[model samples]
Target: MVPEFFTQTNGRGDGEQTLAPDSSFSNLEEAEKALQELAQVFPQPHSFISGIGLDFATNEVSKAAVPPEAPLLNMEAKYRALVEQIPAVVFMAYLDQGIGEAYVSPQIETALGFSQSEWLEDPVRWYQQIHPDDKMRWSVEAAEMFLSGKPLRSSYRVMARDGRVLWFQCEAKMIRRADGSPWFIHGVGFDVTERKALEEAILEISAREQRRIAQDLHDGLGQHLTGIAFMSKVLEEKLSDKSLPEAEEAAKIVKMVNQAIENTRQLARGLHPVAAEPLGLFSALKKWASEVEGLFHIGCSFQCENPFPIHDVNLATHLYRIAQEAVNNAIRHGKSRNIVIGLSGKNGAGLLAIQDDGDGILKKQASQPGVGLSIMNYRADMVGGSLKVQANEGRGITVSCMFPIRSPE
Candidate 1:
């Protein structure tokens, strides 16, 4: 038997109405007649009872189609929530169309002290907010990333809404259209001001310590060794005047003491590079190359083309140390017989390169670099330059550092 139930319209816009049976139907014919009458009254596709026993085919009802906007609304809510919760500012900008930001995360306010609305109001605001000193470098890197469709990773400073300079490490990937054209850039900016400050502090401390050690070696150990060498020479001369065989051995002792003194001086120079400021980078490099050849018995040479002097002693020191490390690696590890150190300036930039003819770097070492290579790379970055070490085609390795020439303020 069909279950007895009553139906009423709730007026909730669902187009649903409930109805109750007027009388019990004994046969299918009577029930069909009643349903036909009810269908006319309702005038809509709906379920109806066919007889005392329900008929599955006749009682089944069709549901209304769900609106298309519901899923979109749900997805938009999820996206907004995700963007707001992220620590970095998430952004998407249209590249094919003019330079316009399509969407930015709510975290923009927390990152740069700028409201989401303010960022969206100005199309060129991103370019305008970069620190003036960093704009050119950032623009070049950004343009290259867009053109190459490569991921971008850069650290730069920006002027926040409150006029405070903040450093950000930005990472982005380019989105391409169906035709392989640049469409959009999706990226995140992480605040790195604290990390940058720490790095600067560490670098300063390292430089100061290096200077102290160099001073100790030059004034303390070097002076004592020089005094010993002089005393030994005097003893050697007195022994020679006495016509004794001991004079030869005393002379040898004097020579060894003098060599120790020279070695101490060389170590001091390598640590602090006092000659970098007085003799300039080119002259200092020439002296270093000659010393390397004399000490190691390797053919080391220095060459320069239109050599211009660098006024910044700190920058010169960093570059010189990088070269020194590269040359030492080539000689000690690569078993190089000959090395060439080259210096040149072009287009307001300086290039320092060291090439050695020896067994090139092994593939494993290149993948997992040692401390010396890492230190050289760190020095290059400290001087606002780039360092690249690669194996030559046939033999040997090349290390190059390129840095821009900035005028004194």
Candidate 2:
């Protein structure tokens, strides 16, 4: 076998070596000549020859990439200096050829809970330290990018070596050799856990407020309004057959009482449902159309159909108010002779449209002289819904609203 040649540097930046052969060198002069030639070419003193091995034939040189002037020590000092000066922890890794088994930075001990030695021993240990819920998703995405030769960008959680859970946003890219094969991967990570917690807290508070308001509308004011409606009916019936000398006066009083009872029923409905069942939002629109027509001596027609159980009390209330307000506006301000209200829920959500044939908006009219439309807009926003109002074509006004049933989480 031919002997193998090895060389490294010693102190003073001078290249030197010790050579061993399977069988003692046949010619001492040739061995000395080969060693001197390698020393002249390298000539670095601080590098050390830590290992030397030889075959019995074919003398060839193969050495570890240990630089002269204490390479490992110099690299450590450079990294430590960087970590101290830079606000973020400094990291470096010796990435294996397969893009696995990277030498994670020593700063991991302070940034995360894991030690650098443990990660170097097993690169997958870092994956194990990731939060269980986010681990699979983040890992799969990272692997896809790495294997497909794309830059790696990801955010995930890590249970630190100190047992603290932290969120980190990481960015990395592959380092490839001249031939286009990946050589190593490098990346940086920083903590984003505090920002994430703050966002969650804000969402929790908003949801709690919405739930409380929904409960109040469904239980508190709704019950009281229902009682008033029943009592009004009782008074109307008792006054219906009265022994009064003025029969016409009695008749007019009874008529007004009946109207009051109807108005009170409408008010109670505005607060909450008396039917306890969904009352199907469209049915509420029809009731408004009838009331408006009778009260203002206008012709009003409504045709609507929809599914029940809207699930959101606030949304249902807002939708009903939008219809009521539109009809009232047509009667009081537009001086409408005829009105048409249409409600549809088949297009995946509730839709309300009201149109009236009347003298449309008076030009430059200030204050509009009605609270109905303003209240309608406010209620719509409270439920996270939308409303649209515009003058109808050729002498009329139209109001329309759409309510989204789903809540964004």
lDDT winner: 1
Q: Candidate 1 clashing pairs? A: 7-18
Stretches off by above 4 angstroms in model 1 are 1-69, 99-101, 111-113, 120-123, 161-163, 274-280, 292-314, 329-370, 383-409
- Which lDDT values do the candidates have, in the order given? 0.78, 0.61
**How large is the C-alpha RMSD of every model relative to the true structure?**
12.5, 18.8
Q: Which stretch of 10 consecutive residues in model 2 shows the poorest summed lDDT? A: 48-57
The TM-score of predicted model 1 comes to 0.69
Candidate 2: tens digits of C-alpha lDDT, residues 1-409: 1124543334555555444333445796777665455445544411423323222133443343333555678787787667655444344454454324444556677787566676667747777887654554555556766688777555566788777878676677777779877677677777767765665466446545654554564456545555655665555555655643555555565566556555554544554532223555556667767767777787998876544456554456567767777777777788889889887664344567889888877765434634666677665544434556777669887887655454322
Worst 10 residues of 1 by lDDT: 47-56
